[model samples]
Target: MMERVHVLVVAAGRGSRAGEGLPKQYRVLAGRPVLARTLEAFVDRDDVAGVATVIHADDRALYDGAAAGLAGRDRLAAPVTGGATRQDSVRAGLDALAARGAEPDDIVLIHDGARPFAMAELVARAIAAAARFGAAVPGCAVFDTVKAVDASGRITGTPDRSGLRAVQTPQSFRFGLIREAHGRAVAEGRHDLTDDAAVAEFAGHAVTVFEGDPANTKITTSSDLQAAELRLQTALLDVRTGQGFDVHSFVEGDHVWLGGVKIPHTRKLSGHSDADVVLHALTDALLATIGDGDIGSHFPPSDMQWKGASSDRFLRHAVERVRARGGVIANINATIVCEAPRIGPHREAMQKRIAEIAGIGPDRVGITAGTSERMGFTGREEGIVAWGLATVRLPVTAD
Candidate 1:
């Protein structure tokens, strides 16, 4: 039989513990939403066939807002409404899958949306064990000593920790088996199971333990969020960077385009097209890093068709070029130099224009003014000068 597995993401928690005023799954970690990063891990893995997230019925706005800007949003299965308890939410998720004609015996991995740090190894191990045992859970052997406490908070007795292990999810299972397990529990009027593994055990199923990453801790408190943020920041640091620089001198024209915006200037860059130096340089740098051809190759200035073209189109074309090569813009730092028409007043507008055209945020694109110290052509007001450095996230390639 063909293997087609789907993940059930339980994100309906109100997160009373974390106290971040947002659901634990929706909390902002670093610059991205917590659950977005969680979903990305599996979505990037080719082994996962599908994904379905469970959320509170009333959190539609929050869910949509967070889901936007994610790398692979189309692959995400429609979210199902969750219930009061975590067990209820899981059952609801199963029902949603059943309505879609999912097979009972098919593989399904149930994961906590709060545990964004769950590594690919843990996922692989759980899937491996589940395929063999019908059910598999992730855990680490209990390391510290344990004690049984009384109502007065005094140690009533000491318990052995040698045989105990703390389990984590995504707990993998045969979909048909887990659905039946939940149905049986509801019929039995019992609903207090801690995790999916416990539910399977109650249904006479054996769940094997696979070693899990210690970093895969649930986000229950502020400290947990802080730790997750730190891990995510470290991951973001390895992001790729690309650089570009372009210069254009004064030509007899009515207007000049800077960063995709037309500005009133006595002289425009001398080119066959509306030579926007800022956009041209940024585009050249972006394409340069991806090994894509320069603007001359894509839209040659020698061609009359590009004459008087809006610089916005040039920027958009450049952005599409980068995305086509599976890379993303990290940051853009561009400098504009000229003796006339101060660039300070237009800095914010230029940055906004660049960000919009580049498909990035205003924060990711920056603009600075440069003077030739009244010594060079720019200082003499004979021409204008512009340069840009574009940093992009280019996927690693095997040489």
Candidate 2:
């Protein structure tokens, strides 16, 4: 049987040095909270069995605000309240997992909530190293010279940098070993152990070292946060704009759906589903931005399951697709072409509904209405048409 991999993120620190009113983990980074991005890094991975966080006792509200929309993820466990020190916080997290029946052979990774840039490669290496060595820590080799100073700040000894390494987390260990190590530390009143690896080493365990990624830097100050934001912005420089147009004929009905809103009309639009032209066009536009197939390909007209289905489902699925790719919908501009129903009265409601479905702000959704100037099929009042343009920002990839 495979050993399950679980992640424990330590986020209970007050982080007063970050210079933000909120804790460093809760601070906004690239339009998302630092803790949210950190949690997603683990939750989105298929190899990770589960993820739990240790939060400050008073920061429950802050943690919730940062972890908005992630609480529903299947792999995310309820957060545990931390004690006074970092060691205490990790212990609390481990205890929570044990209470949930974690096996002794399972692997647990102790990660810093401030480090959000640990790539999948690093995670795989950590898991492999822990499985092979029982207790493993990641570290990067130091290049600069090192010195030991006395209390008065005088250099006492010059150390060789070639033998030095700066350690990093996701320090991985067998669940039972680390739990027993932490328990021993608690019994011995050794609360000053800085990290999980130290706890293991203090308990006479031989800890192995694995390579750590330099990009997985911790956010300790305002400057680090700024650099991380800039890095993320640079990585998401692939901006794309997609256009989609949809038309549906008028049929015999008293109401029509547009942009997920039901409006009273003399004739409703005819399609397999509630023919929401605006939402359909917007969905296609979003899918186009990601190069995914069109609405018909995803939800085919031949599929009876989607018969009379609400178009909001389509738009919501598109939004989730974008999110899955780490893409952001910058804005959605859609033009509604119709002669009847006076779209002007329902424009605000339409924008709000579309925004709600797209998981963006109403201000980011632009709704424009126009007539076909009595020339085309829309001009003949036979059908309603919608054209949508979606702007998206995605991380640049080799593909």
Candidate 3:
């Protein structure tokens, strides 16, 4: 039997050094919260079975808002309130997992919530090393000369640079070993340990090191955050625009669904799905942006699985495809062409629904309604039409 893999994300630090009024982990990085991105790195992986986050007792509301848009919230344990120090927080998180029935043999990766750039390949290496040696951490080879400095900033003896490695997080270890190490440290009044690897070493466990990515940086200051943003900008140099148009004919019904919003109408739109014209168009637009064919290519009308399905599922799938390609949906602008149902009262709700489905802020989603000058099917109240324009930012890859 394979042991389960769990993750502990320590995020209780005040992060005063980051120069942010809010906790640095809760600060916005790129477009989403920093902690959300960190959680996503683990949440999207199939190898990760569960995740637990340790946060300060006073930061419940902040944590809630930061994690509101993440899809992996269901995989998270009810967040454990952390202690005064990072070590204490990790212990608290481990305790929470144990209480939730984590076995002694299970593997746990302790990661920093501020380090959002950890890649899946790095995590895989850490897990492999831990499984082989019971303790491991990802580290990068030091490239610059090392010099020791005294308290007065005087130069001391230089250490051998060839033997130095800059260690990173998602430090993996067996559950029993790390728990015992943490318990021993508390019993011995040793609270000055800097990282989990140090704790294991103090407990007499030999830890192995695996190769780490240079981009897996911890955000400690404002300059670091700016640099991360610049890196993201460089990677996302390819911007593309896609347009989609959808039309649905009228049917005998009391209401109609548009952009996931149900409005009372004299008639309804007819299709295999809920016939949400707005969402259908937006989904197609997103698919086109990613060059993933159209909505019909994914959910065919001939397939009974999508019969009377909610169009929101299609929209969500499109967004997931964008993320799978290391791209972000910059904006979605949709226009509803109808003459009967007054879209004015429900425009805000429509935008909010689109944002939720796209995993972005509502401000980035735009919705408007207009008519076809009483000339087309929409003007005649025979059907509704929707036009969508999607702007996407995708990572540039070498062709």
Candidate 4:
């Protein structure tokens, strides 16, 4: 049977070391509070049964605002007000969960609120380990040379860093074991602690460690924050941001046209097809969304099959490929981003055209316009460049 999960996130740190005006957990990183990232890491996982956050009483406003924009925000259990020391605060959190009727044997992940970079797979690993071994935590191999230094700043013998390790949060446990461990630690007057491992060890329970992501570093000192920023940036680079530029230079021919239909212009566009850039880019984007080949692969440039063919036909064909695989357009937000003819007046018409070609609702088709302040080829009015995002949802069964 699957263990009922009640992940307890501890976010009451005052963050005196970072020296920010607000608590470190509430501080904004990558447009959301640090704690929001941690909560989302839990909410995104299908195995996480529930979540309980322990925060400073005064931080309710910050918490609410930060958690607003994330999907599945309702999964967060009600806030528990924390106590003086870290251990006291943890006891208060556990009590709050018990007050909320969390079962004794359910697993609880006691994660540091400041560590926001834990990935979904890491969370799953902790849960699986907890189920098998009774407790687990993500840890990285120690890199620096360990040493036992004296109070007088004299060097002691250098110790081996190979066997040493640095532990990170999302520490997993059998709920009853952790609660009992904390209670015993309090009774024994053992208060010098920084992590749940110490408490569990004192209670005579065996704990296991697994390989952790190097990116999962706790945000404490200013240098740590910088390191976190670098990791976050690295992760975000996977979004595959691309600025696509396509321009059909004016050629000696008939009246000019763009976006499938004819628009009054001085000269016609020269391309293998009707040269509707908006539609072509949208077709390519649909292909990109599915991780298939590009637009050129589906319709080669040299093929007379598409010569002078309406660009709408190309987009419609791409839509069919997605539909054949049981995929539908979730949303398509695009920008014309040019300085040629005014796109504002034709924006709605463009949306209508794209909706028909994409086989999606007009509401799902979005368009925005911007000029480059006369900086590049687009600013010089040489051509129009467009950028867009197409989000697709994978097929899934209801639980």
Model 4 ranges off by over 4 Å: 237-399
The sequence of per-residue lDDT tens digits that candidate 4 reaches over residues 27-121 is 76643467876777886456677788888878887776555434444567778888777888888888888887777778888898898878778
Please, what are the lDDT tens digits per residue for candidate 3 over residues 1-399? 566899999999999999958788988776667887888888767788888899999998767655654555567677889999999999999999999988888899999999999998898888888888899999999989989999999998899988999999999999999999999999999999989999999999999988989989999998888898888878898999999999999999999999899999888999999999999999999999988999999999999999999998898888878877888778899998888798999999998788777777778899988888898787888999999999999999899
Ranking by TM-score: 3, 2, 1, 4
Measured with C-alpha atoms, the lDDT of residue 52 in candidate 4 is 81
Model 1: residues with Cα > 4 Å off, grouped in runs: 235-240, 243-399
- The residue pairs in collision within model 4 are none
Q: Give the root-mean-square deviation of each candidate in angstroms.
A: 6.9, 4.5, 3.0, 13.1
**Candidate 1 residues 1-399, lDDT tens each?**
555677899999899898858888888765446886678667656777778899999887666655644544456888999998899999999998888777976788999988887777888887787788888899888888888999999998877888888899999999999999999988998799978998999988888888888878888898889887676555444355556667777878777788777788887787666778888888777777677778888988778889878766766677766655555567887888887767887889998777656645578888988778898888988777777787776556557
Give each model a TM-score.
Answer: 0.68, 0.78, 0.87, 0.60
Q: Write the per-residue lDDT of candidate 2 for residues 240-328, one digit (tens) a residue.
A: 99888899999899999998889998899999999999999999999999999899999999999999999988887787788788887
Which model, 1 or 3, shows the larger lDDT?
3
lDDT of 4 at 282: 72
| Clash statistics: count for each candidate | 4, 0, 0, 0
Q: After superposition, how far is residue 388 of candidate 4 from its true place, in Å?
A: 14
